[model samples]
Target: MPLLILGLLVWSVPHLFKRLAPEMRAGLGDKFKGVVALLVVAGVVLMVIGYRGAEVVPLWYPPSWTMHLTDLLMLFAVALFGLGNSKSRLRGRLRHPMLLGVITWAVGHLLVNGDLASVVLFGGMLIWAVLSIFAINAREPEWERWQGGSVAGDIRLGVITVVVYAAIAGIHYWIGPSPFPM
Candidate 1:
């Protein structure tokens, strides 16, 4: 749990830093760019390990039906993440697809895993998503118009998202403990 908390702090702080302290981020980018990259990688690795380790503790059991719902939500989250990186109509409509993705992911996990660690991890992410969105809106007063791109790009992004989601779902079933273990 301590490791999990540390990982969450590490993951959230760096992300929040960019939103809360843009000047500091810029200075660090200029001064300790390489160190920053190393730290970021280390933080992500820790977060992954912490999350996986924490999953061992079953704090609460969700009904079997909820797992299906979680899967669907995760798929949508992946699609949102994909749209975030593309010039799709969904991106323009969402305005903040990346943040939406984080929220969806966090919420989806929270519904299925009711353990203390899961709550802490997913709740922290949810808080970060909300705060980061607020910070971004506050920092950037001017609304930038969404980029217009070819429909082909949108199709490509959609296909990629579906493929990646399917791959992950398959991997989860094959190598990981059943996420919907009854």
Candidate 2:
């Protein structure tokens, strides 16, 4: 749990730093980017360790039906993630699409997995996403709305999103938990 908490801190702090502490981050300059990257890697490692070490303490028993809901949320999450980085008409309408996707993903996982480790892991990420969005909004007042983009890009990206989502599902099953229930 402690390691997971530390990992969460490591993952979120450097990201929050630039927005929360502009001057300090500026002072660090180019090196700051490297530091943030290293911290992110270390954070992932720690979280993986912590999560694996943590005992399973189920908070709530999820119904089998929730698996369907998780699947729906994951599809939208992946599509939102794709739209976030893609040149699409929908892209202009969102401020933090990727963060929104993360939120959705965390919510989906939380809905299905109620163990202590799962809570700490997903809930921590959810909080980080929300906090980071607020911090970024506070720092940058003006948002440049999407101008225009070809629908073809969106279509292409949508196709790619489906493929990537399937790959992720496959990887998830290969790992431990099967996001796609049998």
What's the TM-score of each model vs. the native? Answer: 0.87, 0.95
Candidate 2 structure quality by residue, lDDT tens digits, 62-142: 999899999999998998888877977888889999999999999999999989999999999999999989988988979
- CA-lDDT, candidates in order: 0.80, 0.90
Candidate of highest TM-score = 2
Error of 2 at 142 (Å): 2.2
Encode model 1's per-residue lDDT on 1-182: one tens digit a residue.
66667777777777778888889788776666666666667766877778777646677887777788888888888998888778676567776788989899999888888788788889988998988899999999777767676688788887898899888777888887565545
- In terms of lDDT, model 1 sits at 0.80
Model 1 stretches astray by more than 4 angstroms = 55-58, 179-182
